[model samples]
Each structure stands twice: as structure tokens, then as C-alpha cells.
Target: MSSVLPMDLLTYWNRYAEAPITVEESRERGFGWTQYDRHGPAEELLGQPETSLELGCGTGDMTAYLARKNVRAVGVDISPVQIEHCRQRWPQDGAEFVCSDVLTYLAGTTQKWDAIFSNWGALWFTDPRAWLEPVRDHLTDNGVLVFSCAPPVEGCYGAQGMYGNGFRGRVLPVQRWAYSPEMWEGVLRNVGFLEVYAKVLEAPEPDNLGTLIVQAWAR
Candidate 1:
């Protein structure tokens, strides 16, 4: 599979490569501040394993957490800036940071991980089918694919919307795929995931539909 760079999304995230890691500072900057609460830590989701991959890891915060738990954690990101931040911030022996498009990296890698996860990462920006097979191929038997994404919201269709402030005061449009839980389950099943679980949890704030939490196991 050819790796198509999602340049717009990468550029938008680059702006936050140097952003603060604190919840208060992140919330102020409009990043997903509640991600920690939504998905918990890596070990909590997948248990302490021998090896794991944090897909689309922004600043490698969760990647660091996984490494701390004695898992050899590899954090992959499309943005070089974010990967650089990860390397500098964590500097752990077991943690590795790679600057590569997630899809391309997955397709080209021979590594089989015990667990793989993404916390509202670029998985939202690509077709579910595109990555499912690669994930299955790269995950060890019984390994799980866990991720959380913005559940469908009012007027969130297709792959484009107002996302961020661009260079020189311009507004950047977002690109993401926000499908329903049932739709996601079907795709996961069709792509060889043995058991698929999906749920929409209430958002912390009212007036929002909530988040879609998904876990599909490789049997």
C-alpha cells in the first residue's frame, strides 16, 4: 500500500509539537486534554507486555508511560517535530520514537507487537479498512487493537471541517473520518478481527454525544 501523507493534519499538529504537556495548558490550547481520563494509561488498557506500539503518538507521553511499565514502547508519529519532542522529553532506554506516517510504517514493518493502541490519533483521518489489515498482520496472536475517537457529532460528516488556526492568521480545515460504532464494528469484523467491542461513553461536558471507545482482538 502506498503511504499518502496527510499534510494538512501533520502541519496542524506540528503547531503543538512544542506545546505544554500539562492538562491545564493543553486544554487552554484546545488539544484533547481529557484523553488521559478517556483511555487511561497504556498498561491499564493492554496490561504490561513485552512490546507495544503507540500509534500516532503526539508527544509520546503515553509511550513514555508504557516504557515505564517495562514494555519496550515504540511511538510513531507523522510529524518529525512531535517525534523530536518525544525523544527529548522521555529519553528512556526502552522507549523509541520514529518519525513516519503510521500507515507506511505499519505496512513496512516486520515487528509483531503484543499490544497496539491509538488515543484519538490519525486513525480518525484514514479509512478504517486501510489500517485494519496492517494492524492484524503486525499484531501477535491475541494482541488487541484499542483506540478512542470523537463519536459522531452534529454536522461532523466526511473528512473536512474547521480544525485549527493556520499560519499567518488563516483557519485550517480538519480531515477525519467519524463513523458510527456499529459501522466500525462491521469493518473490524470484515477485516479479520475475531471479537469487536464498541461503546459510546458520555462526554465529560453536556451537549456532546461523547467518545467512541473500541477494542478489537486478533484471535
Candidate 2:
């Protein structure tokens, strides 16, 4: 099992933001082309939401898209540099980016969101009950939260799973999490979200990793 340090990952993403341009690895790891084929977060916008919050927005590409939709969109990420890139791409006054762990913001802040969504994001929570409840609490009464999560491709639980087989004692962390289909179904119900739409989509690619997508309506 491999353990993940969420804050550390955020700081690493910040370094990418300082680069002259988006790096090749960042482009791949951020997962736009593959995730976009299935989720198309931009296309799903229902038109000018009164307010929107996106968690784990990498490079803030989709957040910028949301801003242009004439919606009040705010993106929260753990990376300061990522926030900087976001600031540069879309200068709309209403589109804001924050530097904080999504869980920390959700737990500490009293703000309620009108609509919440994350793409290729929201899977860092080792304890779903702990992390997800915060997400649910941050949602307004009639609000919606949509995100994509995946279970590990193989046996991975804590440190061993996350780091994979260490080569000569040097550990490399690969993709870290995945959820069983049934596990996801139950989590939403426990969080008081009614099943609106759930689908298993082919991840774009030669690799073609799969995605378990659940978009639920809040009760």
C-alpha cells in the first residue's frame, strides 16, 4: 500500500505552474484529452449557474471555460503556482482561484456552493467518509456535486499499493486510487445524493484506462 501526501502533490503541481509552459508530464497527468472525451465538463454546463465551485482544478483549464460561460466560477486547488496559471489564462474578475486543500476549505469554510464539479479530480481522500462529508456540507440545498474517481488498476491499499513494486528501493508513485462500482454507489447514497446518472465510459486512448463517473442530484 502506498500513502499519498495531498499537500505535497499540490506543491509539486505548483512547480509545474512556474515553468515556461505547461510540461509534457503535467499535460498527461492532468488528463484533459482522455477525461474530456467522456466528461466534457464544459459541455455539461446548464447555462449560467448562479455560482460554481470546482475542486482539484489542474492548470485551471476547465475553470477558465466555466468563467466564459457567464457563470460565477471559483476554482480551489492546493497549488499556488497552479493558481497563478489560472489567473493568467482567464482574467475575468468573477473567476477566482484559491490556494488550499479542497478538504480543508470544505471543512473550515461556511460558504455553500451552487453547483460543484470536478473532473479527473477528487480522489485523494483516503477516508471517503471524512472527505466526502465536507464536500456534501459545502453544497447548497439544491446544489449538485459531480466528480470522477477511479479504483486502483491493481492491488493497492496503503503504502505498498500507492508506490507499487519499488525498483531497487526507489519508489515511484503511479496512479493511486480506484473505487469499486458498488462502493461508489453506496457512498453517494450515504451522502444523501440521489442517483441522477451513472456510467462507465471508455477512457480515451492507447492506454484507455476506464472511468467510473457518477453525477448525482442532491436531495
Could you report the Cα RMSD, in angstroms, for every candidate shown? 5.0, 5.0
Q: lDDT of candidate 2 vs native?
A: 0.62
Count of clashing residue pairs in every prediction = 0, 15
> Which residue ranges in model 1 land beyond 4 Å of their true spot?
1-9, 22-42, 154-173, 205-209
Worst 10 residues of 1 by lDDT: 25-34
Which stretches of model 2 miss by more than 4 angstroms?
1-7, 15-42, 45-48, 124-126, 150-160, 164-175, 204-207
lDDT (tens digit, per residue) of candidate 2 on 40-143: 33335333357788887767766666676676788887777777777776566457888777787787789887778776654443356666777777777777
Clashing pairs for model 1 are: none
Instruction: Give the Cα error of residue 125 in candidate 1, in Å.
Output: 1.7
Give Cα distance to truth, residue 25, candidate 2, Å: 16
Error of 1 at 216 (Å): 0.5
**Please, what is the whole-model Cα lDDT of each candidate in the order they appear?**
0.74, 0.62
True lDDT of residue 93, candidate 2: 43
Candidate 1 C-alpha lDDT tens digits along 113-203: 9889887776876676588788889988878888887787655554544546644444566667876788778878987887988888666
